[model samples]
Target: MTLRKRLFWLFAPLLVLALLFAYGLSQSLILSRFDRQDAQLLEGEAVRLQNLLEQNLRRNLDLVQSYAQWDTSYEFMHGQHPDYLRRNADPEALSEMNFDFMVFLDLQGRVHAEQWLPPTLTDMFVLDGQPPRSLEALRRAILEQARGLIQTSDEDLYGALIAVQGVPLNLAMGSIQDNQSTLPSAGTLIAGHFLDGERSENLQQQINGTLRLLAADHSVERWAPLPSPGVFSLNRAELSQRHLPNEEQQQILLRFSNSLGQPQMLFELTRDRRLYHEGRKAIAIFLAQATGVSLLALLLIYLGLEFAILRRVSRMHQDIAAIGPDSSQQRLQDRGTDELGRLACEVNRMLERLEQSETRDREILDAIQDGYFEIAPDGQVQAVNRALCNLLDYPAEAMLGQSYERLLSREDAERARQDFALALANNEQIRFSAPLRRGDGSLGHYETRFSLIRDSQGHFAGFRGILRDISEQVAYQNQLLDLAYRDSLTGLGNRKAFSEQLRHALDKAQREQGRLALLYLDLDRFKEVNDRYGHDVGDALLQDIAERLRRTVRQPDRVYRLGGDEFTLVLPDSNSVAAQKLAERLLAELQNAAQIGALSIDFVTPSIGIALYPDHAQNPEALIKAADSAMYEAKRERNRVDLFHPRLLSSSTQSG
Candidate 1:
């Protein structure tokens, strides 16, 4: 029936609820962080496995190139020697090479000599028409799929995953030639390995993950069905989601589409689920801590109400008439050694211990790296830690009675006040990202975690919060964003970035009822220079073009190199005249000779096409298509700029 007991009964459940809510919020945030880590990790694993596959193919192609350049092989293919197979493809040599199959083909696509590791297992390859067992089926598939290898350059190597049998085959092919004999050519040399071999086992061990290429489309049968597509229970509909959800197994699926836009293969990875498990374990530990801390806080609140507020106020006037406002270190002098005097002595000792505990708690709060503060419901600062004082570069005396607006802009402070009021009404958690005004007048980003305070009457009294400086985290995210949107070759915005920018610009134009201009540009004769001078020169030329674009466009304009010799520019709030004039000036500047390491290349020129929103098309994709069609029209004339017309799309469609 005492005042202290009444206060404790009223607020204990609310304290526990606050702790429970905090746990839930923390669990959500931690899981999301883990999910992001898993996604990043899966992406990294995909790249590694992809590179591993390429390396295998490249290694095989290197051997093929070596065999093709052999003068003896060239002579044999040309009918100058008959004992070539006996000398070169002996069992010992085949065992040392350790490849699944090797085949030699003449210039006329006729198989000359073929050797396979397991010569007895001839049923490994299967084609559409041929019987289930025929190496000839494979040869025909190669001829049909990679006939371009017939004219492959001396340095060029062709590598790809081919569905020959029931699994993806890593195949490498190259043209047969003699670098020493100056012979016109021999034919083509091909070498490859099936994924069911020892090589695949070694690959699995390297990444500590299972890798499988899943055959997806069954409606339209493949010409080369994977002979052993493995025991996958997931159907085409399930595979469309990309991954099968599993807790113990973290799976990532990357689907490979064929030329007809049908899913052909699914690149699946089942790696260690350590990160996910670690996240769950962490949440469990946090739950235990939350429960323990909540109980401890409940006890403290009850004792403080009894000792400091209710009992102290009731007994203070009678027992401590001599005590001063700053006389905290002073104690009441009890007169006798009776039971009442003994109880007074015990109470004094308890007060001293409580003082020490309060000091320790304040020290811990001040030691925290994140800023912490408490405010009245009216938004006045009531209490703060040393870290918060340093964070805002304000003295404690200066900030203790001030409004939160001192640390936040008027708009931000108002929003925060609204958020607090909403959370109080709904009895929910509060957290938000906001920019805080710092001492030097620059704004710093912070994530504020908020909790409400209540008086003895259990009414709205104040608020408490922790402000975590997230400037570094924000900068790191920005850096990642830059990497994602930027082209590595020319340092211009890439296709992904262009797509987003175009969409955003279109949205803005529609909202404002203004016009947006999109320019699609292709460099004329860029492939000629790239073929003659190589990629280094091509890269220099692209960078030069990107620089020219940066210099020509206004600061508000967005420029991007879509891919290869293709470039795009998004101009919001641009009129038709401004867009046309910009394109013309860009074309004139591009015509100027580009200097690639002292090589004066005057042949390079740009073919630019302009498309305007509300004038040409409705959406980003359609606008790009229209601009691309107009670009082709300019390319036909060479070194020219063209405007998008509805007929341009029709003409292109008809030509196709």
Candidate 2:
């Protein structure tokens, strides 16, 4: 991208992010405001519910106290009570008291008699062989629960809502003492009220929240397991408002306990999330305003950049594009002293310096002894120095405009293409040895270095390279290798090559899970011949022996002369049986070997020692030593072959 476009993206996102930050802050403030308002509304509802329930509990407890102190309540209790179900009876006072149920306890705190104010005012019927819970069993349960739950005590009066048979009921318990403060308590009385009654419903309507009463039974399971029930325990914190599964509703829970302080029920209060919706609408308005301001800001940024930098840079680009390296008279025009103006002035100075640098680079490229060339983007050789032309034995006119591939051998051409592409991708230079076809169609090895060139915009322009002829260097290296590993006289590998080849053969046998035989031979009576005759006969005889052995072994085998008359043969894929047979052939080959220029030399027979891989030794040194030991035994006995064995190593050691 142009500098102008890059600057625009760089500054444009910053302005947009600034606008986004403003919007984020606004949203945070609005959410905090909504939280405070919701807190106030939920606290108001909780306060109202608490006041109403507390007021009713106090008044009901007072009424229960008045009832428990009556002399009539004492007469009604403290007796072996007959079954109330034995006769149809009406407790008229129960109706007058307007309580749900009442219980009378004896001095021992045992249930003596009870009265219930069921909605129907009668417990005269049975269904499915069962008494109605609201009449018979419910009244009995209330009175039985009043028995100190352990022992009799002079406890004070108490009232709370309790769940009986999954129904929430209000209960108040007081002592049956005299109206005056002088008398001891005679018995206890527990009065009750239905929490889900008309009066409670009217109280619920006083707050603008929906109310639900959950009895402390399986009915309370939908709530979470309590680490601590917040309000009733020590925390006593305001109940956190619950967001209902429905997105638009929220809830607050108020808990109540029974007379003994056991958890009894929950009053779940829910309200529509009016502030939540209003806050979302307010955020929408904020985002809309922010978008407009951000757009205006972005436009101003874009306009300022266009006027200040982009137009000038565009003109500079056009002017630079129109001028070529040959146009030495052309130069850029300066506008002012701003950054772009200074940048243009610097660019004009750069063009002037580049013209001078180009001349100097051209001179350096031409003056260097190494051949130099430049390839255009189209893979055509655009320019070649006189050195390259002379090195290739071709004129400049014959080489220019030709694709570089034509000058290279097929394999090296493909390799050069890959290296060229790598150089361009990595923005680095590469050097490799490649074979180039000379003008005579003969191939000469050359080391090439390739470097990529890019234009002002960093687009690929072409490739430039230097080539050095390495034919003489490569030939000298080969000669050195030959002198190091070859025996000049015998025309076979020397001791160094034999060691290397033996190790290689062992590795091949091991890899293929095959075997090979190593043969160590000594020309018997040969040193005596060297003593009598000249060294020339001895050397000539050894060369002849090497040739005979080469023809005797298989093609995969290799032969080496370890100086004098000592020779070694590597026979791969050969077992013991194969080794013995080859040794026999070698002995027979030397039997008629006296044809050294009419000298009957048959007396020079070989003492061959054969060692098999794995059966005798695994590595090259051990195998060779084993074979050499066996060869000495053969030499001691003359003109016979011996196979290497463990005992031969020991015997050779003893003789030494």
Candidate 3:
């Protein structure tokens, strides 16, 4: 073999290998893009499914509330009208409301009436005696929850999801009341919709996916009677034996919990495997095409180029050496009619095309609205787009060599560094929202997505990311939260917030075996002040009173305005004596003349009633009523504080 033959043999294989490597890389990139898109689609679908489940329960709550708030329902609960039950308890009525169970209970938590929809499912709700072994526990749980709802106010109804007999149900409870007639809560009306196999199948059909539910207690007997709940981790062979064909599907698990936040069930969604198989087929075809092209180019090079091209290549190098950055437009002098001459012309055209491509890429980078940045593995800023320079209030030259830490506030930089460390360890992309320091010394909120960059050998190179300003969105969310929980006039926790806090406090006290104090206050002669001082002054005085009440309470102790001249203070881990002392101090504080912008109001007094938990009442609504009754007693006496007592309700109202 001669030198030419040896060179050809070696170079030919090298060329083919390079082509194969390039094809593999391209195919990998395509497959990765598809995988990412599919994952995102699955995640979005999962969120939509969760929202649909929640909305279903909300609709049930609305239906139950509508019936519970009717005057006829109230009269029926109080045993004044039997016709109300005859009309509403019918199967047609229940089916129209999409309710599987409708139970009416008295104030004492006794079931007055109970009916099941599709009435054939009546066997599933047997709570009277010796219910089925599978449903007895669930029936008892539902009754316990219904009794608990009697303590809640009639202001609004709420819904929840519960599991019974290994089946999920949407449950809503409301207090039966006639608001217009001032008819008190006679009882509560509980309604629910059973989530059986058919309902689950309907949900899956709507989302175009396979849905499976797993018991949270690891007792799979109720659903599939599996020996254990570790089926999620079984291998393909093991799953096949169990008749679950998950080999060609991707499973996305969404864990759902009960209202108390205990793990209740796992909802698993399986998506089709078509995208993956299609990607594999396309990649194989690309590899085969790459191989054939590589061989063809090698054959042409060996047969035609070796002898004739070398002499022309040398001459062309000599001509290229004469060109410079500032050189005028020039063409090669040796214009022979061969492949070499055509190659020279193509080279010049390629250089011109390359210049245009670079310009377009630069323009695209500058046109992006969000800030884009690239950082070295050592955390130094390597490059940035035009938007980043403007966002950070720095010139490109100034920002290029600086560290990412400089562009952020101290706290944010520290947090970002920690996140970066975690990302590097996991070798994955991350997204987060945080406050960023801008160039104008003002703070802005940004949602940033950071992706890791790697070299050909899969070594970490650096990071690149995009930052989108979300200051307005964050501000609007916070504003809405404030409006929901804060009183417009007194700047205190409104009724809603106070209710939540009271519920939390009561739960904590019950769990820890502690006590809490509730104090209800009514401003004495408030109507006279509103009449004499005008509404504006009265409003200002109420604001002043709120401040005074807030100041009287210690940290973590809350004060709330329940509309009009009524206020309440919640003291966690307190006794009746502490409650009385705080109430007296609040009354003393209010006695001081409220001077709001030169308007002095003398002789402003508060009638306060003190009630202690686990002493006056064990439930929140009853505790509040006890304190309110005591406050009314104090009101009749004028300028006095009173403690809640069982006998206080009888003679106290007589005096008023």
Clashing pairs in 3: none
What lDDT tens digits, residue by residue, belong to model 1 across residues 54-152? Answer: 566667767777888887778778787787767887666766766667788887867888776643334343222233345555456655555543453
Regions of candidate 3 where Cα sits further than 4 Å from its true position: 1-363, 375-383, 394-431, 458-463, 507-515, 550-557, 573-581, 596-599, 612-619, 643-656
The candidate that achieves the highest TM-score relative to the unseen native structure: 2
Poorly placed runs, candidate 2 (over 4 Å): 1-44, 66-117, 121-134, 147-153, 218-243, 259-262, 360-373, 384-656
| lDDT by candidate, in order shown | 0.73, 0.73, 0.74
lDDT score at residue 36, model 3, on the 0-100 scale: 60
The predicted structure with the larger lDDT, 1 or 2, is 2
C-alpha positional error of residue 601 in candidate 2 after TM-score superposition, expressed in Å: 50
Compute each candidate's TM-score over C-alphas: 0.45, 0.52, 0.40
The alpha-carbon lDDT assigned to residue 212 of candidate 1 equals 59
Predicted structure with the largest lDDT when compared to the true one: 3
Model 2, clash count? 1
Clashes of 1: 5
Clashes of each: 5, 1, 0
Candidate that beats the other on TM-score, 1 or 3, i.e. the better one: 1
Give model 2 RMSD, 1 decimal.
13.5
CA shift of 271, model 3, Å: 84
